[model samples]
Target chain A: MQTVKLPPLFTPPTPDSPVPSVPFATPLPDIHVTLFRNIRNAVDVRNLVIKGDPRVPECVLINAATIVDVFQIQMACTKALLHQQQGIMRTRSLYSEILFNLSPTNNISDAIRQFGISDTTTAVAVVMVGMQAPPEEVRLRLLTLIEGEPIPLSHLPEFTDLPLINRIYKTGNVAADRGQTLALVVGAMALKGHLS
Target chain B: METHEAILIKQGAEARVYKMPFGEGRCAIVKERFKKAYRHPVLDEKLTARRVIQEARCLQRLRRAGVDTPTVYMVDTPNSLIYMEYVDGSSVRDYINSRAPMNDDDERLLAQSIGKSLAVMHDLDIVHGDLTTSNMIVREGSQSLVLIDFGLSMVSSMVEDKAVDLYVLERAMISTHPDTEGMFQCILDTYGKSSKGGKAVRKKLEEVRRRGRKRTAFG
Candidate 1:
């Protein structure tokens, strides 16, 4: 389990709350990521996402093999937050926006198809954003939803589909160093919609 | 307006740069173009939005062309904010000022690198409108030159545009650093050798220098 606390950039406009609110003191919510391998309920999780199940938190379920590093996820999460802040999300939900932000293209369906979960997926990375549940509670809840062993994020490299990622990102050669590949991939994702 | 803690590092005429914490204990530089009260709201919004998109486009294009640039993290269009990688290094301006009487080899090396990068940039039709020592950073360990501040950058394949770009850098170098004519010459020599259309741009640069940046209809 890995947790990334995204610091707030700006205070949200104060709503008409019954309690008096401080002018500029809202702490932005954090994003939590948990890796699961040997999953048996990928189809079920996908179904939940399709149905927009209330049981699921505001989260994005990604095929862990497609991820190059944690930084990639962090970048995607940051983009998603920006999209949400601007009220310009292309997808129906923030989770879908995160998944969309991870892809190197502007097509929403294509992004989901590439990064979203599949029926045969054995490894998954669950990214939850701004959840009120504690980390332990979230992990336990995820165990109920997904029949898999929770693995540390450091083990992600072992399951990474490098060839697939390279093809998707068009990162030139296979021998490219991890740092270079990561930079190229992140650059592609960031430049998706704005490419001219 | 949800507010997070961000330290304002630089307040320029166009944007306010903030060093904010990103995820995974990393930091990102956020450039927010504040709203201008003087201009009409609609025009200001359109202009700011266009510049933000243009800046991001140029940075990504250069990065794809294998130029060392700060990786863009996110662009907030509504807020006019561009989040980018926080380059951990000093500006070329500071580096040059700190080094008292740099050796010939060091000057040559730096000139060659700058010339090569500029060549690549111009070859890609990117005119870094405000190229200067202050806009380039020397990375800490690698000592690689990373270009920054694409606020005025644009894509134009015209020889005149490319020439003007180089002229801007030359004038900036002359004014900012003392006794840099030899260094600028080295830079131009390397650029002429490396870039595909460098010869044409160099010829045009001579004309640009003679005319002093702006072209006159009478001339």
Candidate 2:
């Protein structure tokens, strides 16, 4: 009789700060994040969002604005960032399409207008969703267009557009609990395409 | 069985359930609907895709209606897999069977909870086509009844549909626990008291039973 040995599968989460497993095909991609605290050229950015320059495909267009709430922006950019870093364009156009995903409605124009980058976006976080290159190189690339100081991801809550998110998700009357609100939004987002 | 990382938990004709890691610390139940060899490849793919999407939508709708259900993490259509929160609890079927229903107050509570949840779901016009006790899980700590599996569910506003939903449950109860009609009565009673439409549904249920008896008697 032949005996088959199964590999030990489950790993218990230790007390040592557990790193969230990256949900990607590629191994480890250096994620670069920059927080732009001040934007002197708000109108310019908004103009770039409204109109397009075909020469720069990845640059500003209708969905190219970075004005969405931190959470929504994070969700939209995460996949694109990962794919971009991996040099795989699964969802070819992430900028405009991702903005569309953020909104609960079917109106692509409205979604882009509401969730896309806007003129009022004073603080913006540029997160490298993929770790293809060095962090410094990714950071430098983001700074080419964005004008602001680089800050840590922990400072994100401060940049959260609460009222806008509440208005968009229609959870304005939700109780003043950040956890509950985020859960509701995440649930809504997860059920976006299929809502019968 | 090709057991690489995922542990097979359950297998049915339509799909296979596996226990897999969801995130760093948590586990998830992945229901994978494999391609059927008997059917045409295209037809099989379309059927599985539609069912997976439909089930996920029903789960979301149920949660929004304030009914307890597993949270859906992601729906991978191409793979025909639904990654959902792993609910750790005993099925209501086993729970009721092990404990003496006639003497236990908790059994009554469980019945009432199920009734109330059914009322809410019916009110939302969500008909749980399969309402067996096996589809409900009694949470280990909270004792809250979390309904699972909405693959066979649909939306309907008709009183007959709601009544039929209850009737399905009634039939299941009779089959699963032939000696516990009292518990089933409690379920019906609680369900009837929970909503205004419940009375009408019960009336329709009686009509359904009468028609069922007449067909059996004549045929």
Candidate 1 residue runs with Cα over 4 Å from true position = A10-27, A52-58, A132-137, A173-175, B1-4
Q: What is the lDDT of residue B65 in candidate 1?
A: 75
TM-score of each: 0.89, 0.73
Candidate 2 scores an iRMS of 10.3
Return the top candidate by TM-score: 1
Expressed as tens digits, the lDDT of each residue in A16-125 for candidate 2 is: 43422321121222233455666766566666545663322243222213233344444444434433544653433656655565666666777767765667767655
- Tens digits of per-residue lDDT, candidate 1, A1-196, equal 6876664554322223332222232345677888999998888988997887877765789998899888888778767877777788888888898899998888989889889999989998999887777777777778888899998888887778988998887766632677767777787787786674
Best by lDDT: 1
Candidate 1 per-residue C-alpha lDDT over B1-219 given as tens digits, one digit per residue, 9 for 90 to 100: 455566767768877677766655667787778677889999999999989888987887787777889887776677787878889999988988888477889889988999999999999998999999999999889898899999888889999999999999999999999998898999999999999999999999999999888889784
Q: How well does candidate 2 score on lDDT at residue A118?
A: 69
Model 2 Cα lDDT, one tens digit per residue, B1-219? 232255667767777677775433446776777677788999988998888888887776666666778866555566677767788889989888888545758768887999899998988888888899999999888777899988788888989888888888888888998677778788889999996699999998998777652224553
lDDT of each: 0.82, 0.64
Individual DockQ of the candidates?
A: 0.39, 0.14
* Pairs of residues clashing in candidate 1: A8-B4, A10-B2, A10-B3, A11-B1, A11-B2, A11-B3, A12-B1, A12-B2, A13-B1
